[model samples]
Target: MSGTISRRSLSSPLSALALLALAAGAVTACTGPQAASEPEASRSASPETGQPVGATRHMIDNGGHDLAFYVTQGTGPTNVLDSGGGEDSSYWKDLVPELHEATGATVITYDRAGLGQSDAVPGPWQVESAVSDLESGLEQLGVTDDVTLVFHSQAGQIATCLAQENPALLSGAVLVDANLPPFFTDERIERLVAFSQPQLDAAKEDPDDPQNRQLLSTAESFVATSTAFHRATWPDTVPATVIVSEKTPFDGSPEDVQRWKGAAESFVQAGPHRTLIAADDSSHDVAKDRPDLVLEETENMVAAQR
Candidate 1:
């Protein structure tokens, strides 16, 4: 959770609903086959959720916005490593390569708008737009593989929405301590919105600074986070598992842990294919604290799919 990120890198906070994997946590996933020699049809290829061949680092043109994304090729079903909340793709450093090696499938990771190298839209950030970018990014990349999406913390909203809307696109999913939309009530949403407003105000005042822009970007997106949860409908078709952390990181209260466990239990128990696991000796970042358990669940999901 502690590392030196060069000047003005406003990475999502460690506890702000996010998690990461590893494999040379360096910047720029620019290494792979050169895309220049590929045909236009091949380069502009992937289906909405399919994987692209011979493409590594690239920018996506999604409705006038340029989103920075990168892919590490592998084998099996495409695994989409999406971190939650203020996080970008870099957070999943430790887990990425493990899954890639285990599944032998192309792993897709990227910075959401304004998070890393992705460009920010001018208007206030919304959940729907963020999800749109992900779907569109895959299509633009010309990916059409069966995907097993991995979501953590706040990014759970995107997972649920996608599962509900496009069940056929996903083969299975892993909720790595994900946030269940139904668990967020009115009181919770108000508190989160309130906590983020001050930072947003300060960033607006100093809009020119890089740090300020980063703060502004997170704040704007967070504004609608709760509402997105409210609007989301959990899909019944997506076979998934909810991995819960025994140690509390998002909240310190004993009640919060119980609440999370309760939500996770209900989420997985709703369907026969789903299950819940209480990750032992783990924090919110379970992937880092207990990589074996995380990898086990991931591999299990792939096996079931196969």
Candidate 2:
């Protein structure tokens, strides 16, 4: 639909593939909390919203690499906000305070490897490794239980794997227009790979770029990763809230729009605690468009846990 795909689009496996295919040459891309009390230098105020940015910044080691996380300390259940592909913790800057103030729960946000202030890791991006990065960060922060994860876009994949692998680490989840297993059927994967071929070829010209690196890495393992992801299940023990955008990631194609919405529906229907909320008049970036709703639902989830 649009002439170009934003880096945030990279979060959705299919959305990025389809949009990248359409744009071909016109793609623009581009946390942790911790043991620290240092103020963030680069982040202070949102130029647009003027909201104060994230709290104290800290860096933690994930294996040999460093990942950045920011924390706004509170007392209740911890709310961990994760961005989609090509995005960092700053994406959630505005909402971080709102969430902390409303729920009084510590709000933690981080940059994935190679994005934001986090160290770059060579090779393609792997879901398992992303899970490890999150896992390591949480454990190091002494956050072992009662974490309410709020993930958007591509982070959904990581959230899905984490839920299955470490249900005990999470109390509830808010999936903001994230990817789901039902959407990654064999046919969809085939179509996604086909559409993404042009972008994959384009990425080769600048593989060193962070955005390109992610694209290359994702393309390298998408087939197998998505296939496995499709087979993976979310733990029924974890309560989840699924927020589907009005114009899902595939807003350009009416056919894809239906499929994306249907997949989210299927994901919610399959579980008991899982609930689906429609984000009206929003694009793929639901948090940006409907911060109120995101905060409301997230606070509700935290309230439910208490």
* Overall lDDT per candidate, in order of appearance: 0.64, 0.78
What does the lDDT read for residue 26 in candidate 2?
16
lDDT of 1 at 174: 87
Work out the TM-score per prediction: 0.76, 0.86
Q: Candidate 1 lDDT, tens digit per residue, 153-228? A: 7677677766776677788888888877655666555544554455566667878654456455555545355545
Global lDDT of model 2: 0.78
Best by TM-score: 2
Which residue runs does candidate 2 get wrong by more than 4 Å? 1-15, 18-54
Clashes of 1: 22
Task: Pull out the clashing pairs in model 2.
Answer: 31-68, 31-69, 31-110, 31-111, 32-68, 32-69, 32-70, 33-69, 124-217
lDDT of 2 by residue, 127-186 (tens): 777888888888778888999999987888888878877898899999998888888877
Superposed Cα RMSD, model 1:
9.2
- Lowest summed lDDT across 10 adjacent residues in model 1 is found at 20-29
lDDT of 2 at 10: 41
